[model samples]
Target: MEIVRGRSVLKRTAVGRLQYYEKEEPSVVRRQVEDTERELSRYERALEQAEKELEALYERALGEAGADSAAVFMGHRMLLKDEEYRNSVTRAITGERVNAAFAVETVGDELCRLFLEMEDEYLRARAADIRDVSDRLLRILEEEEKGGGRCGRGPALSEPVILAARDLAPSETVLLDKKKILGFVTEQGSANSHTAILARTMEIPALVSVPVAREWDGRLAAIDGEEGILYVDPDPETLERLKEKKARQEEAARLLLEIRDLPDVTRDGTRVELYANIGGPEDVEAVLGSRGAGVGLFRSEFLYLEKETYPTEDELFSAYRQTAERMGGREVVIRTLDIGADKTADYFGIEKEANPAMGFRALRICLKRPEIFHTQLRAIYRASAYGKVSVMFPMVASLWEVEEAKAMALQVREELEREGIPMGHVDLGIMIETPAAAILSGELAEKVDFFSIGTNDLTQYTLAADRQNDRLDDFYDPRHPAVLRLIAYVAENAQKAGIRAGICGELAADPSLTEVFLKMGIRELSVSPSFLLPLRKRIREICLEETENDQGV
Candidate 1:
């Protein structure tokens, strides 16, 4: 048996026939004009059809999977209507005088080439999304050409198989026939990409970036998605081993559902709030499914990043309100526009930084652009009226910054009340992600209602190492004594100040460190929705008294 390896996007086990799906790239030629008007009309119709399909997919994925998983379709829908994309395609068809299908193919390939040429893999994967959407447009045009006929066109599953592809786009995955599919293996994709999130919602194991998967067509394959192991044409012994492994995994998943209903209390009877860190309103579904008590961190920056224009107050308010109301009164802490550092938007006019990760971003951008800051604050405050809502400022360092942010929020609250807008339960908090914030936790905690330690940033700031830099990973340990010491310091200070102290970072999701966090007097853990159940299980098993005397170091 040949063993092929890949990166695990969503961990699960699957054994089935290997189905190779070779995607055909669109090819078009530059031709002379014959009928520009017909070409433009055809292009418009196809674009409209693509938008309708994307919206339907979004509704379906949102209902079944969760908002986080479905969020990628929203971007696709936005791209369909993007002025730059539309204008480019229109010019290609009208000016260049090509068929609508060819025009779309031309524009899409050009844009995808630029994205693929980028140094960042995240940006490069975006090319696949464009390619996916372009194919949708091409199909619409083809059907139009064929007397408006439409057939069942998607991933054609012949059997319950481990589907192999170059990559699975969000729309493509949603449109797939789920009953006939056992799992998925892709030659290229990002684990953190929305496609991975979609795979999790489908409750199937996915192995991605398997360069050899493209060759395993028609072979019997056994996969351990949990460990990213792929057995190509396994021997009988390997097959039996996988059968046992699959049974254990299925049993483990069934047990995890029970953990959701179980209390997130330690054996010693100390209750900890098991919360989920979300990106947008759609994630509330996963949070509820995982039985999260509250939302510890809602990264509001996504609302800003996904658009060419700034999101309006109403747009931001609706999203926040939806999440708050959906949680059914559970606390939803909305972190205000944390859009600086590595996340700069062209519309925001944020200057390029020599060191973006440590530069003008998040709170720095918000504080500078008072108009942008005030708009989001008002929306968040307004959303509070629906259910339990709290505001969290990211990258906060100084007590004065907290006071300034708090003052602006209060000012916005009064402005809303003056305008006859009703507001509800509002709690303001600060994130202790910098060394300065950790060191000044006692003073900072005194002013805020709570403290959420963002370990991803705290570790980087404290250790002076870039967390995203692969070469420096050894230097960027979240379990480093210094990082733990800072966390311990914050926990102690929050206790002294009688404020709620929680962790909403990658550290909070690590089960091995669950006991360590509880020992530090940290009672709230905000993790990814998928981690809620596992972390809860770990929490219930640990006795805080056992690690009571051990220093974090």
Candidate 2:
């Protein structure tokens, strides 16, 4: 048995047949074609067919997978409609008189190379998505060339297997069968990468940067995601040890299931509202399955991010309405478009900043661009008619910003009332992410229905560290005294104002900090669906009074 160490993204064991996702880099060549019109037609038809295929995939993914997962196909559909991408292929086909298939490969290759050359890691990693979408178009063209028209559905595994890959894009991961795929092991990706985040969200055992995974194709392997170890061609002892570890993990999961439907209560009987933070309508399914109390942070930004341009009020309303109705009267806190910075859409025309994390983003942009902000508010207010829906503003720093956001919502309410549209009770809340918000939580609390502390941003802003920067890992501790103090301060002030105070960030899912939060009397915790059971178990195991007395924590 050979052991390889890698960075683990979750704590679990996966034992199964290994299947590697290795793509053969094609050798693109400009080939002369006899008829240019036919070749151009082939390219056009290929894009059309690719779009149709992606639409089918999106629908299937929506029904089977969740909305965030289904969004990958929508993204693919967008790429298929890229004007520049289509124009580039057309230029190559007409100008060089090359085969249409060859022109597609040529343009796709150039785009992939260009994205890879980008300095930003987010942009560089997006190279995988570009390649994935391009591959779909080429596959269609190639299949049609071979006299195979409209080959059925997507790729799937025959049986359960350990999915090994050179790298996994968020889009490609969506196409994978979650039930058939045991876990992920990649030759590339760091512990803090997007791949890692997906793995954690899925509760899948994953180890990244495992170079030896390149050679583990079609072999039985054992993965220890907690320890970041992979045993290839395991000896009897290694296999037996892995089997036992898997058994223990399964037992732990079963134990967690026992408390699945139970309320999140501490040993001292302090009941907390355990909820979910979701991005789309499909995520409501996961929330229901997990028995989450409600939707704490419905990231309305995702709808805007996925759109080609600004999502119309009707489209936004439909999505939010579906999500609210599905929740069946559960609390649905819809945060307005928190766009700009790293989470940007091209149509928004937000200029790149030297320090985007700290610059004009979230509520700052929404408040400045009131039209876009009002459009989202109108949709959200309309959706609230279906169920319990509250509105929250992100990146709130000062009292004036709070007053301004409330004023906009008031205008939306007045407009909707004048139009005689059915409206629901929409409670206003603010996301305490900036240090300025936390420090003055008491003043801010008096004006809102609730406060959801976005600890991911709060920790970074409090410590003056970038959440995305790996170099700041040492300095970006959420459990740091300063960060906890701020959270406690918010909770305390929120209590005084008779408002619900919750945490909807990575920290809410952290078992290590559960006791601390409980002691602070933080009433709500909304994490990803996978974290629901585990976090509930943690909450039940803690005593708020005991934890409060324990200074060593």
Candidate 3:
């Protein structure tokens, strides 16, 4: 047993491991490699046999316990077949290999080093994922040597296990027992990582990127997911207060669930459209499930993220059509490709820049790849026939860019007509994400149908602070007078142009900012599904007339 102390931050506590593997010579490596190969072969056979048994068990569990239970059983079965992991073991076994354990250790160390060098905090945290996979594989391989036959431990004794690691992979996250697991704490990760996403989906308390997590062990802890705070070794009084807090949280959750079916109205009645910001068509299901008013912002980058080539017109059309069908006449505002040097698709082959975010990206990428842009436009136009779908271009900096995008959109429409692609008209809009875009909002507003203020990027651009950087995060304040003035300017310009303006940013979800936005004359607020109800309640409580009057003051 170990007793270590550390301050917990953001609902995560880290515990360091006491044991470390010693490095050995090449001869030791050869012997271990031979042993590992034998072990790998044995495990492969045992895994095959275990899979057959598990399949039968799964069928019986499905018969007895239902689909959800069977799904849990089957999920474990699939974990065995993870190709990247299997290949790693194979390399350790059959290849001119180092010791399996040492090889895993070396890979983990190298991954950690690689991640540390990465500029993106999210990507850097993936080092933890590599370590986790290697550790799990080593454990499995070691078990095979011991003739435990891949059924080494019975799902880790379910004892309120608080998983403390440098980071967690998506697969390990999925396999953990949710009921017994208290929460997740990681040394490195971001709110956007798959672990965070899964944690939010499962309603688990999680904290990431805690610098001193290595020092925590057996310390009484509390996690507040909503506030993104973690408390360690709380005094008795604090624990009592936390107990009360936990009760209130439970009650709030119960109330929120009950009101899920209710219309989003406050003590005073006012109609406010509550919408979801979707990343792709798959996210449409979540919007539907949450009973969102519409699709406020549909980020089209997911189409470019994993693809080696740009999506064809037909592919884009099918995606848009599916989203439109799911939205069922609700407004779907699709934002055009926003990729840049920071987020390169293989097809784009974007050159890495010193400051990728500030360099050629977003709308700049579209300008450089007009053919790709035209194909997307044609598809969106064709999909418009299915429902009320509108198009928006991201990172527009000037009236010229807006005009150019509009011209390209029109050209796509003309081309579609000539090609007989069954196109329909859709409203074209521009996102105010860059500093220059905010500065020229009045002129740009005249060219676009509407404006969606992407506050995340706007804040970053305005403050010259990378929000991902912890050291400079304090400078990334959205409520900075400059940011407020920019939003106000854009909204005013949008209104003057006879077009509605919407805010679809992390700031939109902040209840405290709702009145400020309403005062700014913003017509819509698109936020995450979790925040929709609370924000809608805030909107309804606001007297827009009073807010507008106060704006002039």
Top of the candidates by TM-score: 2
List runs of model 1 lying over 4 Å from the truth.
116-128, 147-154, 213-215, 278-290, 299-328, 338-361, 383-386, 397-400, 416-425, 433-443, 455-489, 547-553
- Candidate 3: tens digits of C-alpha lDDT, residues 158-233: 3665556666655445555666666766765566555565565455566776543545555566655555555666
Candidate 3 residue spans exceeding 4 A from truth: 1-157, 160-171, 187-202, 208-220, 224-236, 261-270, 545-553
What is the Cα-based lDDT of residue 13 in candidate 2? 96
Tens digits of per-residue lDDT, candidate 1, 59-134, equal 7876656555666776677667766778999988777777777788888889999878876543555677787788
TM-score of 2: 0.87
Q: Which residue pairs show collisions in model 2?
A: none
Model 3, position 115: C-alpha lDDT score: 69
Order the candidate numbers by lDDT, best to worst. Answer: 1, 2, 3
Q: How accurate is candidate 1 locally (lDDT)?
A: 0.82
- Give the lDDT of residue 461 in candidate 1: 83
